[model samples]
Target: MIPSSLRARFTIIAACAITVALVLAGFMLTLIFDGNIRARAVAEVGDDLRTLAANARIGPDGRLVIDGDLSDPRFRTPYGGYYWQAGRDQQIDLKSRSLLDFTIDWRPQPPTGNDVAIYERPAPEGRRMFVLERRVVVSRGGTPTIARIVVGLDQGELDEARTAFIQFAASSLAALGFALVAALWFATSASLAPLRALRAALMEVHLGRKTSVEGRFPDEVKPLVDDLNALLQARNADLVTARARAGDLAHGLKTPLAVLTSTARQLREAGQAEAAADIEGEVQRMSRHVTRELVRARAGVRAFRRSHPTPIAPVAATLTRALSALPSPRPIAFETRIPAEAAAPMDETDLTEVMGNVVDNARKWARGKVLITATEAAGAIHIAVEDDGPGLPGDALSYEIERGRRLDEQVEGSGFGLAIVKDLVEAYGGDLTLTRSPLGGLKVDIVLP
Candidate 1:
């Protein structure tokens, strides 16, 4: 099966193209070789024909005579892969013994002013020969007589030569094609090296190891790198503006809330208890909303780079130890069973704060033992903090992040409500699910993505 890869695709295309070209070139070479050899054979046989014409003449009795002899020894040997003949009025007057009992296969043509017709014809024993024939005017002893002359050689020799050349060309072109494909592979790897480096730089930026993508890239990739850097800069500027706005909003609202608190206290001292309580309750609610928005406003891009991998084991162990050390009306045993390698994409401080809330809540309500077990699956971290005390019923469970209501006024808190955990978890794109614990207590399941 062909894999879905660029290099594989390129190599396949190159190999196919090279194979097609080599096949075409091989066929073309064969034709060219065959044509060239045939032409050469015709030219060579023409020399023999000219020799036969020059050595012939008509005697005074009107008979053909020969004087000169061919230099090729094959003419003297019987069926020696070469043959020749001379004739007059389509009758044989002289012939080479190499023809044996079988004459050169030919058809006579009428005289046409030194024109020669060369062609291939079959000989004895399934052999083929190229024959060159023409009618020449022979004059000797002051008398002229027209005689037909023919010369030919075996076509098998030209075929053999063509076959040899094709074999050699096929092998040579195969090697050339292989070398070209190999070279193309190396070139492709070299060309894509820049992309791999750019990807690494991008990974570093994504992991928060670098503020922006930086590298010496090729011209084709440099523009993309520049665009990424520009985008990073723009996003950084926007985050700075947002964080500043969040800070300003927090600072601006504190004065009014503080004044309201002061006004509530003044009302209480002046004997207006109901009014004071209402104003204080409103102030507290406003404070919670402001805190939630402040965290949210600083949230958008701030978490992008700060959410480094925080190992759950160490944080969970630390929280369990601290919560266990705190004083409780009844002794509560804290259990921690987190794997060492378990980690989440969260800042250390954020994980500590988030886990601290859940663990402390469990310790506060846990009657005998509190269990904290964390596991990871499906690209998320699941941390469940369970207490063995009386768990909240279905209706009493925390179904909302904020309602300005209290947690049944049964247990005290660190003032950082579950709403804060939910807001923070959601900001980092995690979850907070509250349910009944298996140990007759509440279970807080947090899934951080």
Candidate 2:
């Protein structure tokens, strides 16, 4: 599933809403504008009809005639795009020359009473007309005569005006949509700027390149950054205390361990070989434990001070080279497989010590072959060292891991190697596991998070 961002979703919804509102408003305005133009045309035609009716007169032969000259320039010229005609018995008597010699195509029937008829009709000049016809009684010498007057105004000019308004409205609406989208883009970017800065700061922290976040952030996000910095500081202080304690503990044991070694050497000189050998072995075990603890303590202090990530591949390769330089008669074959760009959250010195110890232990017990593998998985780094030596005894492996426990009373070295591995792993928030290898030997698996 693709994740959606708040800024993008909000911008899209807002733009759509604005566009819908503008469209609705534009439609309403277009209707109102067209209706107003049509209404005014009808009103003007009605007024012209009234004027024609008022000027109606009856001649001596009972023929209808207009009292005033209908030849007023207002009537002669189509100044307002209006036309009119008045007649009796379906015969034209007077008409506006604004028609340009093209008569208004209207048939006005003699009215039954005093009713007026109003409707729309086609006029000359390819325009529509709003027509109003009325019947009037003209009295000459006390005799009443019926006459008809029809007046019309052209609707084409109104239609043209409405079309222009619609075009302008469409253009305006298009411009508004573009402006809205542009504004939304800028607003979204501004709102998300803080998140971007936070991400950059996090990257710096991850790489150990920066100890603190720096930049001005919005009020809402400042607290979050502050909390992160506080957490990092607390962790660093705790690590410092742990290192000091480990160092102090190691220092306190050195005097007793040195005295024990001296006693074992003197016994050997006095020719009590059997007793001296036993004491020497015990002394060596204590010395190894103390040394391992010191290394583990220092590893903790150095893990956070790395200026750059240590690539595991080159470290493994370097270990292979160093081991190959040892003049061993066992015909040992060293095999290494590591990724091209695999890295771990460890300093170079710490990594060298960790890898060297594991590999050296493997070389000691291996009959003919050793293998080293390094890879990354699940947000952690894994390093495995295997040797074709007699696998560790089950009971002995368990006891050796117990604090200050040794499996072999006669073993020539401190049995604290695996325990040191465990301590270093824990210091880095990682894990170390020992298991039987497929080559009928022991496999050391280290995972660093």
Candidate 3:
């Protein structure tokens, strides 16, 4: 599988380029070595041809002959790899013993006066040969003639050396390519280190550990850092402005609402019962809307961004104690089974409000016992409140708790409290659930992370 990381992609590209470079370099180097080796072989053959020329002459019988023994011993060895021949008018007059009557495959061609002609022979005896030939004037015993002299050498030694060189070059290049690819991987890693650091800094900012992303970054990454910081500042400013506006709206409308309440009361005392009823109903509706908006405004996610963790045990105990004091037809017992370390990641006030509403709701319906238990696990807080009273049916569990709407008018509660709790829990990145309790009553479960 291809890696999704930028570093891996860069390494792959670099490896391909290195492989291509190695292939081209190997081809060029092999060509250069072959040319040099062939040139040296040609020079050696030319020297041998010159030696044969200096020693050759036309004998008294008009036949080509040598004045003395050849310097190279291979010239006398039968069927040896080295051989030479001398002839006039395409007729052989003298030859090396190495030929063994297996004549040189010489092709006739016009020649330059002094320049030697050298070329590779076609395959013979399942091996290649290099031939150097020249037409030269020689005289001995008062006889002169133009003789064609040719020297040939087997190419097996040069072929073996070239093969060995190719093997060595291929292995060396393979090792080099590996090293270069590895170096590229490390280089890419080092270059991306700054990006890793920047990501960590952003995480810290998100967790509220720091207000803005901070730390040293590469020049190429500083612009992003600066932009993030500016965004954070702008967000904080917007939150402040929004909070002030909510507060202002609440304060600005307080006097008018108070006056309306006062006028309704006055009308009620003056026998305008229908008018008072209408005014009171409108006022109540306005009051519910204002209260819901206030709760929502305070529970904004950004508003609680810097909130400290609030322990749940103390809050549970306090609410239990306060609720136990209320008079009832039967004495109710409250059990708070929360650990000291169980804390919710929200403000103390908001946590108190959320737990208070849930606990109170449970207390109202509990027959004789209310159980409160909370735990902290894996950076999350889970709270369960169970009551022993008659719980709602499965269909009733979907209680659409909205502002100014009560599920049952017989119940002496606004029903908006749980709605506020739900909003508050969600604002802090948490969730609330209603389920059948093991205690045979309703269970309110909340998890906050």
- What TM-score against the true fold does each predicted structure earn? 0.71, 0.55, 0.77
- lDDT per residue for candidate 1 within 186-228, as digits (tens), equals 9888988998899899878766678888889989999999999
Residue pairs that clash (backbone atoms under 3 angstroms), model 2:
none
lDDT (CA) for every model shown? 0.81, 0.77, 0.81
Q: Write the per-residue lDDT of candidate 2 for residues 1-449, one digit (tens) a residue.
A: 33297787877788889889889989998988888877776676666677778888977766677776444355667635667777767677777778766766556355567666777788776667777788888888887777778777666777789889999999999898889888988988998999899989877776678877778899999999999889888987987898888888888888887888788789889998888899887887677777877877787677664447789889888888988888776878999888888887888877887788788888878899999998888888999999999978887566655552432342334234566667766767788777889988989899988
Which pairs clash (backbone N, Cα, C closer than 3 Å) in model 1? none
Q: Residue 184: error of model 3 in Å?
A: 2.7
- Poorest 10 consecutive residues by lDDT, candidate 1: 399-408
Q: Which ten residues in a row have the lowest lDDT in candidate 3?
A: 401-410
Supply the TM-score for candidate 3.
0.77
Q: Which candidate is the best by TM-score?
A: 3
